[model samples]
Target chain A: MTFRQSPTRWALADGRELLFFTLPGHDCEPVPDRRSLPQRCAAQSELRFDRTTGQWVIIAALRQDRTYMPPADRCPLCPGPSGLTSEIPAADYDVVAFENRFASLTEAGGSAFQLPDPADADFVSAPSHGRCEVICFSSDHTGSFAGLDFRQARLVVEAWRHRTAELSATPGIEQVFCFENRGAEIGVTLTHPHGQIYGYPYLTPRTEQMLQAARAHRTRTGTNLFADVLAHEVRDGARIVARTELFTAFVPFAARWPVEVHIYPNRFAHNLLDLDGAELDEFTRVYSDILQRLDRLYPTPLPYMAALHQYADTDAQREGYFHVEVMSTRRSATKLKYLASSESAMDAFINDVRPEAIAEMVRTA
Target chain B: MTFRQSPTRWALADGRELLFFTLPGHDCEPVPDRRSLPQRCAAQSELRFDRTTGQWVIIAALRQDRTYMPPADRCPLCPGPSGLTSEIPAADYDVVAFENRFASLTEAGGSAFQLPDPADADFVSAPSHGRCEVICFSSDHTGSFAGLDFRQARLVVEAWRHRTAELSATPGIEQVFCFENRGAEIGVTLTHPHGQIYGYPYLTPRTEQMLQAARAHRTRTGTNLFADVLAHEVRDGARIVARTELFTAFVPFAARWPVEVHIYPNRFAHNLLDLDGAELDEFTRVYSDILQRLDRLYPTPLPYMAALHQYADTDAQREGYFHVEVMSTRRSATKLKYLASSESAMDAFINDVRPEAIAEMVRTA
Candidate 1:
């Protein structure tokens, strides 16, 4: 993101400031730490770019073999609270949200990053600031979010609302991301009926971009980008994957997933925590419908990475739109939709199935 | 992405120009198609924001699934100077770079996409103005980019250079991208060793953002963001993955991939085509070394989507860092780096491994 510049704007009713950045060009100049520390990249993970989308794609490919893929019978999430142990503890509850035993975002507070000694062969890690909570979509580990009934799904939403509010209230927590990766096809390590929550310490990249764009729009036009784009998509109706009164699910103008759809508030809302109870119920209705449609689209349950886009912005980004994304990798039931080179190296995209085609499929389903 | 009333400045070698936008706002509004008469988002793929790294991420998750898993022996790309049928004949090619047969951006212009009648069940399409070409990395059907020797690799670079230039010169072309999808693990339809090229007609979302950021930097600080960042990264080498006299490979400050390494030209160049034969040969040296190291790290070849980043300023971005990115999908050759909701949604990354460790492995390998 652009540093020290005017924060990126969102078209929210209450403007919040943000910073957004475009992809960098071909310059390979090393970025100096603020402290002008000696080259310390020797032992740290650094950000890198994927050329196709001109995006900063990550490479956290861990040794899958190193993981202790536990058996389903011995699932940690299903046990009662008393049974929970150091690694896999027992937890009880129909719809429970608890801290992940092995979390990427730890509660330990420290500098955003530890400067690794360039000469050191191994990188030492510093404290990572963020919250990771697992949402028990169902008490039965065998069951999944898809198997949940309407009321149960509503409970999940209630839990989400509670957690979103709690996490957002915490200082230094910039964005609240809620998402679920279901099915082993997409590499869900845990077969438990659970989703995860991330309380970010900084504005996420997506939020940053949205906030930045919104801020710019507000500064120039006193308008909201989300409002404008949503209106356009709705009016055009080509990429509209699904829709309800409260939420409209459509293939984003720029979709990174095969069957990607953003569930935007018909009206502007900055974050999901801001949604009221009635809104929550409405959200579950539309949300379940979207998932059901996804399942019906194919015989097998879809493998997807769905996220809620909640912008953390400055007052200028008040115009930003808060939306939930359902990015399905269902190129086919058995096959995957890989983000190959053009989509990775260049900032361009080529969707084989037209948007209208996707919309029709979702609409009919 | 912001179409503001303030005259948008374009930083060129000469004076600046005020750019205006015709995009809709938060609400979808009817806007005229800049291409031809009836407007639709037919050709240009929609770009999405990657919340973690503040970059646009495109989901080119196309319907190439069935093709992706085709019988390796029957690969059309492997049949050089032969005809599958009289209608579709192949030609001799040691390292072939041809218009992709099943292309998202076809060499032949796309079919006209018409708006569906309100009653039509299927309605999804937009103007598609781009070219999709396949660049065979080797003549051997089973050979991979990793198998290629330095000379063969250099030729691949040459083919890329030729294609990039040709695509860039095309009237409708706005961005020229070159990338490779090596293994079936990532769903390679054809087993032949090959890559892809896309000549975009419009500036992609990621490029647009980069250009905008660079322009802003130029206007405010009279410097390029990439130049500054690159200089800084070089000064602090902790994230540095590999280094060549002409290029530097390092993890980005905001890397999205787990083992994502950026190979940037020491000098400012928009993309791979910018380099001459000697430079490209050297580039191939590092490129091939990295790929070899990648394979050495894992017994099985990794599934990855790599790209070459070039500026699609539509003639605007000056301070960009054009680089080649290779992100290993073998986070653990056995396990994929599953991007949880926090990663996919918030754009905030939680890399499980320290970057320094990844680099050290690569450096030693």
Candidate 2:
């Protein structure tokens, strides 16, 4: 389970670093970027703060022009010939991570973009100074991360942990968000299997709320909020999907999604980097197992989003607990949960399915 | 515009009240439901409070089996003959409001559903004691609220104001929310133009956050948050879509959707009930104008959700501001702005369109 390998890093024509992670004996040769490309700093994003809700909104107008649902042959994520260059230069690779070409957040002062405050001086507007990267789970165009071999999945975990550690140390990066949007049903532009990492300049609203809850819990009761939640779920085994020595996967007591499963490490870990070799190996196994079970829920693929939540590197550890939340909009085989006004505008969830029932189905899956 | 009328109330066979609202001099008849229907208390929802985020999630297991996309002839929201009884017992009506048969929140203690506390005793679980009602915008099933004439639109507004006043006075009701989900793309079960009013037992999460921001702004600036926001928007007229004597419609400073327009009254009205005759008439024209503009943005009908936010009856009105938020998931002619992992999981929004550009489009439409 303890496979040691270092990623071979190279730069794209746009000066975006592309890191290739492979097995010890696998090919890690650098693939030359032959096509002319703009610099990684060609575009930047504007972050506007909403006074009503007190949340920062990233406005990236150019993102509308990003690659849409391209054919498999023309997929930018797919490995291709030098003449018809795609994002990945390598014809084949185990795993890779590269700076997103159409990133919502990039290095500040890039291009001619100016970070300006709103004219009123009350509404805060700033440069979206951070990083967004694409992590290709496999070189294959069609297969998904869940369909990856055990070793390949493990490599992905390693890539995630690696990116988390590196991105957390980046300048001005406050929070590291790692997530994957799978299946075309949920607006997946590309069919190629890949995940995304967003290193945000500010703590995301959800993470801030979570930290506030944890801090309040610590102040009220001398216990970590997440630890207590995990303990409560463990005691109430009816909602548990699976458990291992290092981790437990269960439907949250008040799950927002019809098919939501939260997996937490048994030990107190603030981020994926906290997991040791044995813990990482076991964690990978448990995660892959849960994903397989989720796919079996229906005859076809179950479109889901896997989100990795971790505390900011500069933030206190007392109220931070790293966890992975995998939620699917699919309420039934023929239907998907649409987050209309109640869920979207009001931030109130009306789940048609009970947590216990979802847990039972996941368990049987 | 000064026409006055009261809704005629009647009871369905299942004990749910059905109220008919119409223009003055319109025919108001009592149409009885002859179908042997199940009682309103046959099912109820459970409210589970999530400690992590401090939000209440409603678990309505029976809603999963609620009416789906039935044929237009068999639509439950439509009025039909006595032989084939639908939800609306009336043969014809201008606008109607009735208790939702498959309500997410309903009458307290009417059902035998046990409101059990979680086994851990710390996590809160209670009977979702509130009311959910449906407001039919018109008798014609094919046309939408946007297509309704000036008189009909005004009547619909009257119905919303009536429901808000009545629901807020109900026992245990804290916040009264009025919303309309348009188009099947956003999971509208019935093609018929209608809206819903949910009398929540607690202040919704979004409303709570807005109140917090307003309170903070007041403590810091010694001014009302909403008034200041409106002033700022008015000062920067670039984002204004339309303006009437009493209402101003504009894209929010930090709009989260590609097509988002917020209409706020010029006066500091805490809720819809506070609007006077002249304000109500002006508001109706402004709202209808905005809707018409939104529909003209694309070739086909735009899928959208209209959300009405008002002050909670139980909560203080220090920071409360009544406004209507109209947002569409439609990013372009073909693309949609999906609230995937980034938005849904993290509560962070990445809007693909700029507020000013959207304003220009809406203004010109």
Task: Give the Cα error of residue A234 in candidate 2, in Å.
Answer: 0.8
- The alpha-carbon deviation from the true structure for residue A282 of candidate 1, after best TM-score superposition, in angstroms, is 2.7
Model 1 per-residue lDDT tens digits across residues A1-365: 11121212211111111111111231111111122112211122223442222333322323222225477665655543333221222233445566554444544233333323322321223234566666668657686676788777876776666667767777656567778878776677777777878776555666666677666655656766677668878988878876677778787655556687778878788776667667777888888888888888888777787777665444743655777778776665566666555544443444555456677788888
RMSD of each: 15.2, 2.6
- Cα DockQ of the candidate 2 complex: 0.86
Lowest lDDT 10-mer window, candidate 1 chain A? A12-21
Residue A191 of model 2, lDDT score:
84
What are the per-residue Cα lDDT tens digits for candidate 2 across A171-268? 67778899999988899888899999998877889988988988888888889999999999999898999998889999999999989999999999
- Residue pairs clashing in model 2 are none
lDDT of each model, Cα atoms only?
Answer: 0.58, 0.85
After superposing candidate 2, which stretches have Cα over 4 Å from the reference? Answer: A3-5, A40-44, A81-83, A108-120, A313-317, B3-5, B41-44, B81-83, B108-120, B312-315
Candidate 1 has a DockQ of 0.21
Error of 2 at B121 (Å): 2.4
